[model samples]
Target: MPRCIPIKEIKNTTEFARIVEESPEPVIVTRNGREAFAAMSIELLDAMRMERARAELYRLLDEAEEASRDGRVVDARDSIKRTRDRYGL
Candidate 1:
């Protein structure tokens, strides 16, 4: 079950950090009986970022495939040389 905590109970900003450290579960903060904010650890944030990146990559690959079907293309040799020069590789 999702953990829920009130905003008033939070003594200060650092206290919230302590609560987050002790529990990995996401905490939902409420105010005036309404949902207010959410908190998660860095692990959760990193996982979310990785998931978003993977989704974006997949979408780009799909677009690339569609573009190639329509005859849009890039030169492999030129692309590789540009990459090497840009990165000093």
Candidate 2:
């Protein structure tokens, strides 16, 4: 289980850093007797971000496949040119 700490505990920077460094699980910061946010290592954060990005890419690919099946797809070169023209690139 993750460690829970009050918002006030964040005031002690040294202690907070120690807890984060020593704990493998994420630290949950609570406020007003409610769960607020989680503090996690950069490695964990980066992995989560990469997972989300892969999921998003898969979703876009699925949508593009559906569009292609529906004969609503555009040529890649024309699409790029149109995008460049639209954005004044």
Candidate 3:
């Protein structure tokens, strides 16, 4: 579970800062009785970003299945050369 109490329950800034620092889970900060945003440890944020990148790569592969089945895929070696040349790699 997330480690935050309601924004109303924050008696002071120190308690808010403490929970944000100590909790492994994210804390939802509210403003004007609505969710403002979440705060999480940097490690958790990086893990989430990596997971999103993997998901995007998988989506591209799935979309290309028909091209692969029809032998429309580019050669790996040619693709690598094209990419390297495009980027001056």
Top lDDT prediction, candidate number: 2
lDDT of 2: 0.90
Candidate 1 lDDT (Cα, 0 to 1) = 0.86
- For model 3, the superposed segments whose C-alpha errors exceed 4 Å read 5-18, 75-89
Q: For each candidate, C-alpha RMSD in Å?
A: 4.5, 3.4, 4.0
Candidate 2: stretches off by over 4 Å: 22-25, 77-89
lDDT of 2 at 16: 94
Ten-residue segment with the worst summed lDDT in candidate 1?
A: 18-27
Candidates in order, TM-scores: namely: 0.68, 0.66, 0.60
lDDT of 1 by residue, 1-89 (tens): 66778889787989888777666677888898787998888887887899999999999999999999998988999999999999999
lDDT of 3 at 1: 79
Look at candidate 1 and give me any clashing residue pairs: none
lDDT of 2 by residue, 1-89 (tens): 99999999899989898887777878999999899998988776777899999999999999989999999988999999999999999
Q: Write the per-residue lDDT of candidate 3 for residues 34-75, one digit (tens) a residue.
A: 777788777778888999999999999987997898888898
Note the Cα lDDT for every prediction shown.
0.86, 0.90, 0.82
